[model samples]
Target: MKQRPWINVIATEPEEIINTIDKCPSGAIRYSIPEGSKIKENVSNGVGNINFENTNLSVVKIKVNANGPLLIEGPTIIIDFEGKPLKEGSKMALCRCGLSGNRHFCDGAHSKQSWKPDQIDK
Candidate 1:
């Protein structure tokens, strides 16, 4: 298995890799087929089968977790207070509770604090 800063994936057959990538909940893994590759066309990229080649504008989607962080998916750039890019990626979990030790990012601290979406003091 190859370990990246974000996730670990086992390098294997193309079909198997695509299958694994499809299971990723964060949408962190993406694959592109080469022009002449033999991969089948029916394989799903797990992102609504978006045809990136035919699109001019990248679509970004954000999902607010029930009682947790905000899930960001698609091409994104996260900037810090100084307006400098802190990170760039296809998926990210941003802290909404302000209790994360890793500011701007979630570290599951909200769970520890029993945070709720309707809580008065976030």
Candidate 2:
């Protein structure tokens, strides 16, 4: 299988999703959309019909917390260093801080450490 480039999108609407994902050089392991929303390719672009199958969008979605773990909202295949598959859930928290006892996964260690990183909105 050909390796695809990892793409990160933070869009809420279909138009926004198309615009953002269109910018990626290649598709990613997952494509993130807002919770309770799905990207519909049938939506018209005013000028013409947009073809989603020709696009690089994927079904995987993730939500980034302002001060916490990344809320991955689907089952994503994660491989360990030894090329073994690790069990992931439909909804899981990935560590944002560098102190997770589980390494990549959040172990709620950030709360104990009281680590708050700077926000981009600020």
Candidate 3:
């Protein structure tokens, strides 16, 4: 039988894996540090509340990826056409080519298209 695909990260530095997992736009990747480890956990408080009010995360920035989706940074809440909340996250990749099977969120569908940033007409 064919084994299912998986990720087995082997690194000398814990921060290397942590930093990469932290950049996952869809939150599909996660990590848990073992007890007594030196690496500090970057998580919310025990009650599951993120203290954004005291932090300098007031600014939201959107970066247009080259021939890809729009990368959103900072705290955000994605809403639908009727103002209904869809998803919330610190980072997100929104579909720009409208070919994403996941709709608002990018699933790397733009890579399969022939669209280019320099092209004036679709």
Candidate 4:
């Protein structure tokens, strides 16, 4: 099987991320695999922020850990659902376990919950 490329976008503006996905090519696809579900492909979302890529600003890099929060690096600004900026930092672990006391931010609940992703064999 061919290895699929992964993309991880970390940005202050979630709209920018969504816009890039929405503008993907014809065959370009995105997936939001549940933590316990089987992973059919070795893929994540776009690896870089489209907004930064288009400008002179720094790009935010991210890693989608299986069954965990998104590992992020570089200067990033996080926004809430209402288009309000929530936080800004150089590194962060955004929640994916849905058990965080602080929503959208990882609070180490995955470790306590013993969460693990259903990974595909290489």
Candidate 5:
């Protein structure tokens, strides 16, 4: 088997995540990118809140939407539905609501369809 390049992206740095776990914090670090998953960076959807995540791969800037997709960046992985390796790039979008037919990845459907729950006050 080829030793394919891979990077594990934990919301916080793995080191920090580990420390938090050791401290019995409410955080986890079992982050791992399976062989086949959609990966991307710099997506625009309306909700705006920047997040920086660091991994062995690279630094990623993400945006948090009250109810929207997860915008991701570099050190990304694009995989097929049948668990096949696609491409590794530096920009893409991932679905958060699990409504996209594309599944696992975001095709801008969250914005194109404007599919959010009726509760906006939450």
Candidate 6:
């Protein structure tokens, strides 16, 4: 009946369901629903959106841990050793372990490497 409106008159099923699985021609499956369609017209803003309700922006702060990655909190930017932007425009933990596969960014390498700070006599 979904295929043809005219066929519905002759259908025997008490109820009808017209479920559609749209597939693009290129082969990338349309698994995720488009945001615009699902979002309500007057819906309130949410977290992780680039545009924030609180326009007052601020720099994030970090605690230099005695040993291990810098425990960064609040808003900040991060870059990798290759000069590639890594997790920019946000707050994140940074590796001081020197063994991070991502380089300059913490891939949790401190745990595997067992990094500990050695205080030097200044």
Report lDDT (Cα) of residue 39, candidate 5. 27
lDDT score for residue 9 of model 1: 41
lDDT of 1 by residue, 9-106 (tens): 45467777777666655444566666777877777444423333314337878988767788887778898889999987666688888887888887
Per-residue C-alpha lDDT of model 2 across residues 6-67, encoded as one tens digit per residue: 33343255565555544432122224344455545343322112222323324667876666
lDDT pick, better of 5 and 6: 5
Q: Candidates' lDDT values, in order?
A: 0.67, 0.50, 0.64, 0.54, 0.44, 0.43
lDDT leader: 1
Query: Where in model 4 is the C-alpha error above 4 Å?
Result: 1-57, 117-122
Worst 10 residues of 2 by lDDT: 45-54
TM-score of 4: 0.46
- In model 4, what is the error at residue 38, expressed in angstroms? 53
lDDT by residue for model 6 (1-122), tens: 11434234235521121111111111111122236654432332322233323335465567665555665645555666787766653334566767777666565556554435433212
Candidate 5: tens digits of C-alpha lDDT, residues 9-33: 4456544433333332111112332
Model 3: lDDT to the true structure? 0.64
Error of 1 at 28 (Å): 7.4
What is the TM-score ranking, best to worst? 3, 1, 4, 2, 6, 5
In candidate 4, where is summed lDDT lowest over 10 consecutive residues?
45-54
Q: What is the full ranking by lDDT, best candidate first?
A: 1, 3, 4, 2, 5, 6
- 5: Cα error in model 4, Å: 40
The deviation in Å at residue 107 for candidate 3 is: 0.6
Give the C-alpha miss distance for residue 93 in model 6, angstroms: 1.7
